[model samples]
Target: MARIAFIMLCHKDAPGVIAQARRLTASGDFVSIHFDGNSDPADFAEIWSALSDNPSVTFANRRYRCGWGEWSLVAATLEAVRAAVAAFPNASHFYMLSGDCLPVKTAEYAHDFLDSNDCDYIEHNDFFASDWIKTGLKEERLIYRYWFNERTQPKLYYASLAIQQKLMLTREVPSDLQVMIGSQWWCLRRQTIEKVLAFCDSRRDVMRFFATTWIPDETFFQTIVPHVVPRNELRNRTLTYLIFTDYGMPVTFYNDQYDLLLRQDYIFARKISAEALELRERLGALWADEGSIFRPRTRGRGFSAS
Candidate 1:
């Protein structure tokens, strides 16, 4: 049996978080959570209580005060990963998820799929890719320093952003390191995860450079993991579904979208709200009925060290 460690980063929606965790819990799967430090303890009391009795569930003692497009998000995720790795040393794989994320496939299917495939499932694109940089979004994110203060007033925040854009205080990222950006959510093999954590521990310079970069969570892992692991061992696809809106926020799934989610090839879907109880129940029923067999679209050789 393949053991899986789920490293989840959560801020709010206690019920949804618990529901997602409960769905993935199995004899060989462990759930490790890191609640945002900014969130009140009282707000997460329900979550703590729900998982406290479960031996397979663990919580990070030190949480990061996460903010959008800030390094804190990366910090919180790394904390969860480290905690999970420590608690479940025998786990074969580690899946990074958010509180709003729910498994589309059953736990048995996940394990079987991982058992059959050895590549790391992560989505990434080179930072200098024309599509990502055409609008200067990549340049602004990787070059210019962004000072993000979550508590800043809207007007002041815009004003500071405008000034930063005008000044364009660009910094040079290390020439040896290739910058990559992608979805933060991913499923990595245990060996890959261990190598990534080791690389981060030794590379303080790389860490400091990304500390002030916008959305470091999207770049940090993608940038470093490729360097540490063989390119062939990396499958440039994340097994999670995310739909972005014109407003830039992900569209939350509701009961009406249940059919759409089931049709997706992804193993998981995100932004499922607690209020979508009917959808949750329907998915749970499907999970109960599904067989343990997992059929991958394609199979490759097991991962090899670089």
Candidate 2:
């Protein structure tokens, strides 16, 4: 009963969403989700009912208008994390994710690997300190939600540029006021999460200040994690990166790329087709059918990600 929380933000991608839930449950791991409020309740309800019997499923009640770089995403995700943290305070770590993500390995393997390592797989550092987004134009950024109504969502992203090009029109930034940016997904230790929440509370002003910034989610999580982890704990590079062109984080494997993915050192790749004859698909499906996920790449590890 190693506790692992899955934070999924979903809207219209029903097939992918259901497939992912099925796979995770099959793996016998715990998962929690944050569905977009902008989505269809009926559709969500159907999916929820299908998954309701799974002891691992915990759904979030709050929703926000998530945009590319607004604080809404950070705020919403933090809220979800807070809920999961409180409910399963003793869980070892929280693994971040979106609903469309397809795992490259067995879920059980991934969970067991993390369970064994006991390391936080987040990449936070001063590495991107000088990036354009963090250079003192703090008032225009925000976070990106997993899904959105383009009209409302686009404007959230626009605020950043509007503030930059039309508002201040200055390119210069001061050293102390610099902002940071990086990947939004991570696997964080329980203690690390507390620190991030504390930082959010202390920097309510900072979080509030970036509510309208260009893309706060990328920077919000990126910046804060680096600050909280023990100096030696963070990897400086993310354990999680986009899988592929899957706007939902696609990891492209042509019918031919299967063998290569299995041989790679990475744990989660975007996804292989839910139905295919390729090794990964066959293996993933086989493993998935047996109730496994993110497991190691041994020939015996049952299934692959969707």
Candidate 3:
């Protein structure tokens, strides 16, 4: 039996998150969630109460006011992964997910895939060489410090960038470390995670450097993962099928896209709309059905996402 531990970084949609947790637990997988400290207290309570009875579910003790493009997102993820590690040491893999993500494939299918691969499934591309980044600072994201949240404090964020550019104040990524960037969602093997966490404990300075780097959540793990795992053992791909618009926003899956979502080959699809109740309900039914494994009707087709 291949047991998986899901480390979810969630900020909103209590009911939707609860449903996701329940579905994973029902499939005999463990879930560790880090509810954002800035989220509604009532929503967190509701999620906790609903899944309290399940022994497979756990919540991270450390919470942060997670913000997009801030270090807090990485901090929350670290807490969630730590909680999952402490609770389920024997789990074969630790999968990182978001509250808005939904499983597009059956649990059994994913388990079998992981069991056979015996390697990490994380999207990692050379930061300076990759053209995947659509907008914002590229190599400069690592070279400068970002003290303000880009989304919430736009004026301050841009002002800080301008000051740094004017003053030519910059930092360097450690020569030994190869900077990599990719989608935050990943499914990593247990041993890979153990090595990565051990590295973090030993290299406090590296963590400190990334603390002010723009969107550390995307680069922190991506850079460290390669250092721990060999290139041959890494699959530079994400299991979650997520598409971003030209403006760098995820395309939300709606309730009416039932057939489209069902045909997806990936294990999960992200940024599902909160209003997509019908889609969630239908997917819930599929997850609960244990008679047969769900297969994609379409082949050689996948969503165009980085």
Best prediction by TM-score: 3
- The candidate with the higher TM-score, 2 or 3, is 3
TM-score of 2: 0.72
- Write down the lDDT of every candidate, Cα atoms only: 0.78, 0.59, 0.86
**lDDT of candidate 2 vs native?**
0.59
Q: What shift in Å separates residue 67 of candidate 2 from its native position after superposition?
A: 2.6
lDDT per residue as tens, model 1, 25-111: 743578999999888788589998988788788888788888887888888888888888888778888888887777677766777
Which ranges in model 2 have alpha carbons more than 4 Å from their true place?
125-178, 241-251, 271-306
lDDT of 2 by residue, 1-306 (tens): 455676666656666677666666566555666777767878778778777677667666677655544467777788778777765555667777775345555555666667677556654544344442334333323322122223576674456455556655543222333455666777787788888888878875666555544555666676677666665776554444344331233454556766555554555554445444354344446435335433234322123354
lDDT of 3 by residue, 169-205 (tens): 9988987999998889999989999999999899999
Off by over 4 Å in 1: 133-136, 150-168, 288-306
Residue 248, model 1: Cα distance from true site in angstroms: 3.4
Residue 237, candidate 1: alpha-carbon lDDT: 79
Work out the TM-score per prediction.
0.87, 0.72, 0.94
Ranked by lDDT from best down, the candidates are 3, 1, 2
True-vs-predicted CA distance for residue 212, candidate 1, Å: 0.8
Worst lDDT run of 10 residues, candidate 3, spans: 297-306
